[model samples]
Target: MQGALRFGARLVAILVLLAVLYSAAALSFALSPVSGRPQQADGEPLVYVCTSLAHADIVMPSRDPLIDWSTHFPAVTPPGLPAGAYLAFGWGDLRFFREVPTWADVRPSIALSALAGVNDTALRVIAINPPANDPDCRALRVDRAGRQALIDYIRATLADETQSRPVEQAHLEAYYLARGRYSPLRTCNQWVADALAAAGLPHALFAPFSFSITWPLEKPPLLPGKS
Candidate 1:
């Protein structure tokens, strides 16, 4: 019994050490210079990166002159959306997303399953207004070509471009089946970074955490009367 207890303690210590090392590596990468140069994306044709500390979402205009997002996301019109609402796209583990809306809801088994890349993934789309002055949002300039590349990258991650069923949920959000698997290496934040890199926009070398991707952008302060 004593030997078993010692073995368990050692295992716990090893896990803790691993977690610390991972965090340090992530921080180092986040502080390092980004990998790519900014495309010819000047002040116009802006896109936003919204972060919830733990996750990241790519926010784009619902409709533009070159692309009609509604046609691609047919069943994604949530209520109270204005005429020209924006859409926030997030890719994550299906079960983790559906079950754990917040960190408090995370369970060890579910987290392990997601990290193991054993379960499928989904894309969560939220129709929102322009996140102006919101601290969680940071804008990025993308020219027409860069915008098209970003859109193409996002579309390729969809399980079906023609038809998709929205996951039944109470929030004004739609979740669709996604093409990629969710693992420790390809986290949701990493997906956002990859999308940016695909468009030749500024992005991190390794973005396993939200800050790793958002590190280069400026974060506005929280609005008055808001958290």
Candidate 2:
């Protein structure tokens, strides 16, 4: 019994050390910014980057001169979405999203499967009318070229016929089969960071957490006449 107790204590200490190392690495990489090319050229369009406690999402206008999101995402919009709402895109492990609708529902097996790097992933798209003063939302101005690059990067993640396998979830979100592997290293927030870099937008060198992407962004400006 004494030997078993000693082994358990050792295991706990090892886990604590690993957690500390991971936090240090995450913070270090997040602080290292990857400077992007000048994106404030004339006529640049605005896109929003939003974050929750654990996830980050890129929000784009539903209908833009470059593309109509509805055409690409034909799944029924969540109820209460207006005619021209914005679309927020996110990526995560398929089982994690389907089984764990809320953090309260997170299971050890599901979490382990996601971190194990052997699970399928999915893309989450939600229609929302984002508020101007939300601290979690920030606006980024990207030129037409940059916007196109971002679009291409997102499209590349869609699995074949992803639309047919849509999994509607609460919070007015839909999940589509996505092409990618989720692991401890490649988290959803990191996916957002990668997408920003793919579009030549300023991004974190490495983002394993939501704050890594959201911390550097500026809050969106208010619309005309609205305080």
- Leading candidate by TM-score: 1
Error of 2 at 112 (Å): 1.6
lDDT of each: 0.80, 0.79
Residue range 4-112, candidate 1, lDDT tens digits: 9999999999999989988888887777635454446545656999998789999998886668787777666644457677889999999999889788998999999
Clashing pairs in 1: none
- Candidate that would win on lDDT: 1
Worst 10 residues of 1 by lDDT: 216-225
Model 1 TM-score on a 0 to 1 scale: 0.87
Off by over 4 Å in 1: 78-81, 169-171, 218-227
| lDDT tens readout by residue for model 2, 141-226 | 77788788878888898996445547555556788888889987899999999999887776777788987886544334223355
What is the Å distance of residue 6 in model 1 from its true position? 2.5
